[model samples]
Target: MRCSTPVPAESDKLKLDWTQWIWPGPKRVFSAIEMARAGQQPWPKSIDYYVYSNVFVLLAINSNVLARGLMHWAALLGLGLSWLALWVAKTLWREPTRRRLNLSSLATAAVMIGAALLLKFHPFGLGPDLERDDRKALTLIIVAVVTLAMISWFFLVLIRSQQIAGRLRELDEQALHLKLARRLASAQIQPHFLFNTLASVQHWVDTQDPRAASTLRSFTSYLRATLPMFERESLNLTEELQIVRSYLEVMQARLGTRLQWQIEVGAGVDESLWLLPPGLLLTLVENAVGHGIEPSLRGGSIMVMVTARPAEGQVLIEVRDDGAGLAAGAQDGVGLTNSRERLQLLYGERAHLTLTPLSPGCLARLQIQTLEPTA
Candidate 1:
């Protein structure tokens, strides 16, 4: 049977949004696209297209070649006026939504329609009076048709712009989730480290430290407590502490009674808080055991302390082990090296885990910058 990995008791805050049952992502994008189309302004090229389809062509079909020439000139003149009017109207009404695009089309459509209306009813429109009322009527009808076409075109352009914007937003959200998952995975499992743990514990069957044998049992417990609670992206302090406890139990077998452990947690540092990076505390605990506790052949105690600094809105954790301490050459140390890299990736400069040696032992202090206040 395939094993179903269980998530740790990190924070309940990381739960799926149980509050609002929102629309699916694609549908939301579709709605945004539709809205953008409704709200967007027109482009200048759209104006040109509208003018070509509406005013110029109507003049082309309904008038004499000479009258059409004058109307074409008038339409060009009106197009400039329309361009200016649209720029002003959009500024006063639509604001900068279409600030960059060519929106001269809106003005062109407006001006051409107005001119067409005037030309249709006015007796002396654009040229000498038409010989027949029928000719004038047909000319008027054509101008009206162009005016309608220009308005319809502008709305269509707005609708298309909205659809494009919605799709872009959807893609952006998807990209963000992929990036978060990548970072989470990189921070979690360390195969070589796991292999080393078994080897290191087994290397000594009956060494002076009788505790080494029992460490195997502690390792087993640590694995049982930690592996089951591992979540995809994050975990709470409560879950992390369980991993730490099991690890410390196994480590006590190596250090024997020489290693004493203490944990002091302040109030309001809630278990459900989502602050620390996954496997961060593991690295800290491991480094304490590896470089701090194991080196002092006489054995030493490790104090894992945690406190809430509500004034600063941060959580401070200290892992102190009374061992030989870290060497200056410890820069090559893998546990601290990997721990620091993981911290930088997850919290940038906001979160920090540092290894410093005391006269008695080495101390790994971790400061989580943000406190997701318990609700």
Candidate 2:
């Protein structure tokens, strides 16, 4: 008579199938948030996952085999051992020598392979082979390929994260350089403005003009407003307009009927919420008087129109003059250049300054995005 092969009981087969099916649902619930914050990849976790998952896959392939309880315990033992290697890899991977290719990961894979072999061949001398030859070969190939792919994925994540960190540092350095350029440009212009204002005051006092006291008072107000522009970073539309009014008042006294101006505000504009770079309006007005009006034989009118669009969160500022717009091939002066640099530093592309020719003269239009804090 031929020797008969021993078989697993029906209860054992049911127990193994139920355990494999149920293990996956609860196992996937580990904290992904905590893993990200901790700077950990899911590679090791995947190794732990496959420790149990491989058994299920193997059982599916060999339907005639019944997985013993001891086999499950041995797989858990391998998972615990593989975790030791994963911890070692994580610790050493931080070092420069181990960053690209960590040997500890290879050791982890070796432990997982050993666990698969034990599952296929009964451990502790329990019994004959429960799995068929074809199923065993296929299961080993699947486990090995998955293990290698996970190791490669871990290294790719590390390299990409390092590249991101480097790029962020470069952006921060560029921002600092822009800030320094803005401060330097603003500082150089303040002294030149002060000297010119003083020279005008002396011109009136020395010539013994009867309007000296009134001129002195206007100068005082202009000085008080203009002095702060050198130090301030931003000003609201209302405060800036007041300062510009003081400046124009001083100029009107000097120019008499030769200088005529207008300041019109658009409806529904809340000056308190609208912001502008310091002295931006002053720069445009000064350019109008100096470049446009001063060159004309009879002088000209300077019109400053300020309109705010609350719906769009923008402020439109225009300074126009009736003097000769611009001579052929004229370039931006220091004042206009300084204003442009300040706008770039403060608002990047959100603010702009343009000098366009009005029929006879020039129109300086400045459009800036408003920054109003929420209520």
Candidate 3:
């Protein structure tokens, strides 16, 4: 069953680049020159790998045909199969890295070798048996050479593909990190939040209450202790909640009767769930206080709820404020922007955030699954 919010699903699938599916022409050509640097491949192989791989290609095709039928139907099928087998070996052998032959290459050589031995051992033995065996032996050597070529080609492709893929992944990660850094840097002091907290503190401090000033100082200490958190990569859900609670305490001391608050921590949220990027949970609370509670003028109440389902292995955080609520695109504050980017960086497509009007108030929801150690 779905909860108050439906579980989010991946909207896209991981995909390999289309170009990887096709052969890399330039790479193979360059690799060919490097492969034959030994110059042992006397021009015939140098001209085209097909010269070496053709036999295996042919054998594979013929085998497939034979498996289907040995009758007249298999006749042209066998010949076509043979040609295909050779083609496969020729292409595979041209690359030097695999440094070995493909199935087609080995099978082709085997087929020819088996056929030659069979004829030599025929009960009658072919006429001039020595000369017949001599011809077959020479052909066998050529086929062996081609098989080796195909093996080389396969290895080359494997190595090159891995290198290209690794580079692409690096670039993507770097782009994301830079974006995160920019968002964090722009999130210094959101004046409205500061203005509201400070205004409330000044209102109480003017009354000459030492407890109120101490509370205000404690609140300032909390802000100072937390501003450095944004520079961090991650902090756990428990740690984040602790920070939020400290902030709520500051607001409660200042607003007092003007603001009512509820902080509920669900028992299921295990400390071991995972490390979340810093400032995520706090962002939800900050928005509630900044937009939801502060803007009410007459003031209102906010509920901070945290639920964890350890068995299901997920966590949910909700900040609900019973105030004037919000309009479309109402959650575009700098803190929210920082949070969205941090989530995207950490989970790619897995984590989700939602903001909506809860009839009489505004609700900010965060859901996360698989909070295993990033390391």
Candidate 4:
């Protein structure tokens, strides 16, 4: 008698087939499609098609029993039909007319329902005729409906998020353009500043004082230092302080003994690590001198104090002067208004400029949230 060959075990057969049949073909397809579309796919539009296609394929597959050859063929058919549905959905509903969109959606739903029914019932023996169980079938239909609804909701949320992000980007761009325009407008030295400084130089020159030449030199240096403010968005605290010192030098030449100043920097604060909005500090200082000191005949002292509170995550700068305090119901002038607007634009609500009465003087305080240290 001839020896018979041994047949492989059922478990071995299943193991071999698992890799071929149980793999995620639909997920792979979706990922590949996503890659192919990439940035070319429009938001909201592509999302609808993607969701519809996925839901349709899932419904088609879930409505029938899975078999060896039947499963493979069903998957292929599901993929092809889903792709076709996607193409149609993308092309048909493009018109913004509400009636056309409604019609296309209805047509798509009808086709999907008909195909699902045909596959499940096998009316003409196109596939295996699964036994109909009312309870089980009803449960499956409810699940499919819920799944489709959830998918639609998810895509809708995605569409809304993308729209919000686009709006925010456009606002940022507009703000940036406005910032540039404002910077250009502010680039010029106020005519009165030049006239006053020149008048001081003329007074010195008429008296034949040796400091007249030095005063002109200081004015030139101040102009050179301030020119970069128009070109830069921000400056290091130390650099800004240098600019302020240059400004103070020029002002001292004009004010003579009338302008006395002090600057105090805080401990544990790295000036290089911190940044200031361009021209912000200078504006505050100018406001202090113009509004506080110039009006007083006795000549006053101005104090600039910078402090960082690491525990509180804040940086505080105070420009104070021993001169006249704020007038009651005093309206904001152009300098103060422009400074406030710039602070709001750059820091939103996280930064502010406050003018408060301080005993014999007023304090112009600029408070900003500190940034986290970089890695």
Q: Considering every candidate listed, which one attains the maximal TM-score? A: 4
Candidate 1 lDDT over 130-160, as tens digits, reads 3244335444544554455444444543544
lDDT at residue 112 of model 1 (Cα atoms): 59
lDDT of 4 by residue, 1-375 (tens): 899999999987767434423221111111233333332335356655665567567656665554343444545554554555455444422212223334444565676566566645564333334434422353354345543543443344344335444555666688689768568535645678778888988988999987789888878877777788787777788877877777777787778899999889999777887677677788878877887888889778899999988767878889999887678787777777877776776688888889997667789898888566344
What is residue 281's positional error in candidate 1, in angstroms? 0.5
Off by over 4 Å in 1: 1-115, 122-221, 228-231, 332-335, 371-375
Where does model 3 exceed 4 Å of error? Answer: 1-213, 272-274, 309-313, 328-334, 344-350, 371-375
Error of 3 at 357 (Å): 2.0
- Provide TM-scores for the models: 0.53, 0.56, 0.56, 0.60
lDDT of each: 0.60, 0.65, 0.62, 0.66
* Span of 10 residues, lowest total lDDT, candidate 1: 20-29
**How far off is residue 165 in model 2, in Å?**
3.7
The digit string of per-residue lDDT tens for model 3 on 15-131 reads: 545654443322333343434332233224443455435545645554432322222322343344444544564454344232233344456667667755754565332246344
Candidate 4 residues lying further than 4 Å off, grouped into runs, are 1-176, 372-375
Evaluate candidate 3 by giving its C-alpha RMSD to the native, one decimal. 15.4
lDDT of 4 at 48: 56
